[model samples]
Target: MTASLSWQKSTYSQEQGDCVELAVIGGAVLLRESDNPAVVLRTSRANLADFLQVIRQGPAKNSPPGR
Candidate 1:
């Protein structure tokens, strides 16, 4: 969204509508919808790393989707 940061699409992003853009600014990571770039969200490195870890592991067999 800013003039300095370079945004790139997610590696896991396919040709489908599910896609996110990433940009690194200073010590923070910025994320936003590829379809709607105006709505941007920023997160700390630690939080982002944790989120990615969870996504990679995925949900347990007996657990719900959000678990």
Candidate 2:
């Protein structure tokens, strides 16, 4: 169950205010916003890795300029 998983918030998050948290459960990764813990998003490790990689890469090619 999610209650047993150890959720961690990013250090980049502000000291106060809601932030996203991540947890690893078996072969899946769990994510939830601090303000709305009940609404959790679950995905595989590979998918999460790919998503993060895209975010780090910045805007995609063929997209509008300066957006």
Q: What would the per-residue lDDT of candidate 1 be over residues 1-67, giving only the tens digit for each residue?
A: 4656798888889978669989999899999887888889999999999999988997878996765
Which regions of candidate 2 are displaced past 4 Å? Answer: 65-67
Question: TM-score for each prediction?
Answer: 0.75, 0.85
**Native-vs-model 1 lDDT?**
0.86
Error of 1 at 63 (Å): 2.4
Q: Over the stretch 1-67, how does candidate 2's per-residue lDDT look in tens digits? A: 7788899998788989789999988899999999899899999999999999999999988899987
- Output the number of the lDDT-best candidate: 2
- Which whole-number lDDT from 0 to 100 does residue 55 have in model 2? 92
Give the 10-residue window scoring lowest on summed lDDT in candidate 2.
10-19
Q: Among these predicted structures, which one has the highest TM-score?
A: 2
Cα-based lDDT for every prediction: 0.86, 0.92
TM-score of 1: 0.75
Pairs with steric clashes in candidate 1: none
RMSD of candidates 1 onward, in order: 2.5, 2.1
